[model samples]
Target: MEINVIEKIENPLLNRTEIHFDCTYQGEATPKVLDVKNRLVATLNVDKNLLVVHNLKPSYGEGKANGYAKLYDSEENLNKIEMDHVVMKNKEATKEEKEEAE
Candidate 1:
């Protein structure tokens, strides 16, 4: 999978940077949120704990996907600004990953 950052908007009030990006995976299935999040972290050179992937949706029958993510300046702002489930979603590992680790 390849990631290309499309846009970045800084929100000082929220203490976060909102990112819009595109993902291209010609032969692979839609990438998982965690997988994309990991890539974003590396690409942005930020701590994984500070990033939250809000959405990732594949285009109909297309090898491309578009998504939105946010990078908070701190974890405190992240927990305060984001929904509880969303924060948990990013923190928890996938079930398949857990099974594989066993």
Candidate 2:
């Protein structure tokens, strides 16, 4: 998959950066948030721990996708505002949380 950043907007009130991007991939399957997060981290030269890929959706039968993501100033700030399920899906589960879930 290839990622191209289309736009970036800073939300000072939220202490986050909002991103819009496009992805080109060579398969029918939809791309995952983890993979998108990795690409965004590399492209933005930011820490993976500070990035959260909130959404990625492919255009039907087009092999292209458009998505939005949020880059937080800190994990604590992120947790205070972002939805629980989005945080859960985008970040790696902590050891304690992993153990509890298991």
In TM-score terms, which candidate is top?
1
Q: What tens-digit string does per-residue lDDT give for candidate 2 at 1-102?
A: 889999999999999999999999976577788888888899999988878888888888899999999999998998898998988788766799989998
The number of the candidate with the highest lDDT is 1
Compose the digit string of candidate 1's lDDT tens values, residues 9-63: 9999999999999999998999989999999988989999999999998998889
CA shift at 83, candidate 1, in angstroms? Answer: 0.3
> Any idea how many clashes model 1 has?
0
Q: Give the TM-score of candidate 1.
A: 0.90
Model 2, global lDDT: 0.88
C-alpha RMSD by candidate, in order? 2.7, 2.6
* Count of clashes, each model: 0, 0
Cα lDDT of model 1 overall?
0.93
* TM-score, one value per model: 0.90, 0.85
